[model samples]
Target: MIHAATVQACLAFALLACVSVAYGKPTGQASGRNPSKAALDADQQFDKGSGIAIHKLDGAQIENLLTLGKVWGFLKYYDPTVTSGQRQWDYELFRVLPAILEAPDRASANAVLVRWIDGLGPVPRCSPCAQLDRHDLQLHPDLGWIADTRLLGKTLSRKLQRIHGQRRVGTQFYVALAPGVGYPVFKHEPSYDDIHFPDAGFQLLALFRYWNIIEYWYPDRDVIGEDWDKVLAAFIPRLALARDSATYQLQMMALIAEIHDTHANLRSSLDVRPPVGHCHLPVRLRFVQHQAVVTGIDGTPPNTSMLEVGDVIAKLDGRPPPALAREWAPYYAGSNEAVRLRDIATYMTRGPCDEVPLTVRRGDHELRLKVSRVPLPKDYLAMGDYLAIAFHDLPGPAFRLLSPEVAYLKLSAAKASKATEYIKQAAATKGLIIDARNYPSEFMVFALGSLLVDRPTLFARFTVGDLSNPGAFRWAPPLMLEPKAPHYHGRVVILVDEVTQSRAEYTAMAFRAVPGALVVGSTTAGADGSASRVTLPGGLFTIISGVGVFYPDRRPTQRVGIVPDVVVEPTMAAIRDGRDPVLEEALRLILGPTLPISSIEGMYRSQSP
Candidate 1:
């Protein structure tokens, strides 16, 4: 998953603050062995590193390690001893990794792995082992690697195959599901935060742990946009040979980004990864038609002399936006290119410098200027307020009557208790616009969506991981929204953009199921499921989309996002004119183009907050 790239100057870091957003009892608890001496030793030595060091790996060594990682991960989930929590898998990896690395050939390495599996004690034959029926499965356990005799050799391959046939089922120590929500929950993964720069063995453990989590536990792994097999092999060397703390963290960031899930990110210090700086330009930037366009400024009465709205930024600190985006893309975790660029734009103006030079295209002429930067407060409390004041532009009441015929509802501040009241008010209007461009204060999927439907309507279906089967996935029942009174008979428009993510995207899906409800805007942040925490070595944490979200008909929404029925993106001309093009388009569809754009421009400015 790691790609070597040439570093560009001032191509510093942007903190990827992805939201850290969480499952059961096993039936076969009586059959498994007690915790082993090795596990106890690992628990006692919790604060120490693996003490393994490797400066580099040749091609053959890399291949052997790749196979070892697969087998080790397979055992971690599949073998009764490891899955029963009797073996400390992380430390077990540490114990075996040095031997695997030193083995001169694949046969010798496989022998080391075989002996390692044998040491776990004989896997008691499961009386009734779990079987793959494939009747209602959305995904089957990807265990083809276990059957590759040529790669794994006859002995190791057969050993893994036998274990697969008797794989542990139910009541796993490593993973489980939430009681009500079916999303996967990882258990007992140590953060190892004490080790600032984990040694070679711990570093490899981190990669193997995360990769296997996605390989087995992630429901959306099928759509990660790459051969997941290749990713493991590619990153083995990168992580095993990580020389320092920054290098280890940056490589982990790149590894997480490969999933292309906006929910996936380095939950720890993201400042270590490049375009590294805290200072940001006074104006907010958004990519319009693939070009960085100035959309809004920070101040109440913003300064427009230096950088006006709709000005296209051709250069930032002498580097073009596209080139800069390329350099920073690997570190920016996103579901799709739209969402990726959306986050990249958020920190495009950020760097270590106090003044950022820019070349702006104003009208037909290029104007070169230097804009002063504001350093965000290091304190999270003040940073939240600063970011709100600077980057966030949604400021108004949760629900408001925009005009005699139209009503506006901003979910950013919406309360569930007022859902009926808002619907009652909007009942008299000809159209209602539900602004989902920002994260909702409350989960309004049923509270708000039910008010727009006439009957119980199926909106979404989820694919959840099976603990017994690990990598296997099966469809849960489709979620439906029951009809509620005061149902607004008026047309509905749900506004969304890249900022719309997770619960926001899920809410849009529910609202879009209404008879005449229309989604208007560009693509949204495609990460739609609840995020599960994956603790790694070096005291690091990352997340993955724990479940698969799809439409009633089984259409995917993980990375594709909620598709808009009427796509409307802000143009340079429209943005400079102080207009909301997406909202205007919704009004046109509802008001039949009778009202002028100027009349719809500031409708929310006078609304109650």
Candidate 2:
């Protein structure tokens, strides 16, 4: 019954189809205003329309996931001023509430929404979440979900037949973030503005998940609604923007910033070398005007000539070294120069650097340096796993034993060789003094508790993320030590100052609750557990805080640092002469009325480089 022209058109289309098939085009690859009939059918079938698509989730899910994302961005990150729990949720609630009510079925989706709003476990919150406690919204007769609202105020038996096939994604995001893996339901509440934010990883996740609901559900509004397309449209372009290492890093930071918790942040790479040479810089640094300046250097080389003892470094590469610290700002983030300098030193070497270059200015003349760098001694390199390494060849230490009886372990945080070799050896002797007055070589903090006992123990527990999927990691106490491999339990004392930070603090804190141990020194720099890097907005980054470490009793240590039984301080003269006042005090405490100063004096006086 078809006309001749129709027949010709059909034949020509068939021929083209054969050619296209010969070229091998995959399904779902072609998508646009115009597409093959088959491709169009597939797109329509998987076309999750608006928020919850009519399409089923399958192969195209990742692409459809582009439907929403909370990528970290500098501009979108709510500032501290705007981030109070109530205000943030208020911004989201007016947008999200209606979505839940208007959901295909609110009753079926109630449990999922409530779970994400659950409060933190141990973190103190004045009140339960405000957003989830709202009562005006209709709940299913069974009081279950917001998305399954059609069942609300209706009997289950009456609705069973019609509601069976309807499926909702549920408020899965919120449920995943809330604490204790339980559903959220207000046992008692009636307030619009009473909600406060949650702490811990689960809480943060809940807050963001709550915001995402408004972002998706409330499509249009004056100040209260959200536009998924607007956010997605804005972000997808940036995601597709030409990728640069710095920009890529920035984008990741932006994603992290969206959570905006002091304890939450991005991570960077840190290289651990073989245990080799010690870090011996012939210079001293001081914090002047909130900037760390080189107050002393051994000699003025061709590139380092412009730098002096009092020179201020304006920019580290293109980033501000001190300013970027706010990103992760851990419990010990800004406690000392040692911590800050360590961050800078590692940041400079993140990428390959045959000859590391730096720019420095003394008064007016600008200068640059190409410093030679080396890895840890090759002999000490031993790989255990991607996450662990043990290096050996480190240079002469910052602290050394002056006396055999007054055993001394100088902690240098050197790569390759473990810096605590002196302490381990001294632990076998009568009295032990640890010097943390210098920088760290490597972040070998896992084995500290292992040296104290011959049985396994819980050294620390790291908690990350918000209340929901808050990740927790435990360090089972090690049962063995290197070298002698038995518990040498003896009189142990540690010395610390501002330079004792990061791994230094970690190593020092490990001694807590151990028998016959004393921390006698000034407060440590307090920058432990966190790893930092430059992230977004050109030189901006998230110094993601580490999960808080805890004692056996599950006491969290974050804002508050480890307290030493006795506090010791140092003098400039003592530093110059390489004598530790803290060590002197520890010796006094351990030696008590028995040992005489003359007995230990000769050993410390015999100096050997």
Q: What Cα-based lDDT does every candidate model obtain?
A: 0.77, 0.35
Q: Listing every candidate in turn, what is its Cα RMSD in Å to the true structure after a full C-alpha superposition?
A: 7.9, 20.2
- Candidate that scores best on TM-score: 1
lDDT of 2 by residue, 551-605 (tens): 5555544434455678764443343344545656677776675767555444555
TM-score of 1: 0.91
Model 1: per-residue lDDT, tens digit, 1-609?
Answer: 111011000001100112322101111121122233456445654346788889889998999999988898899888998888887777788888889889999999999999999998987889778877677699888888789988989999999999888875574877878544567767767666667564888788888999899999999988999999899999998998888988988999999999999877775645665677777777778888889998877766648437888899999999999999999899878889988888778777777657778899999999999888777445422221112322222466787788888988888789988999998888789999988898776767767777888988888888888888889999877777778787789999999888888877888988999998899998888988666767777666666777798999999999999999989876888777766788878878888878766677656445525
Candidate 2, residue 347: the lDDT equals 30
TM-score of each: 0.91, 0.41
Residue 501, candidate 2: alpha-carbon lDDT = 47
CA-RMSD of model 1:
7.9
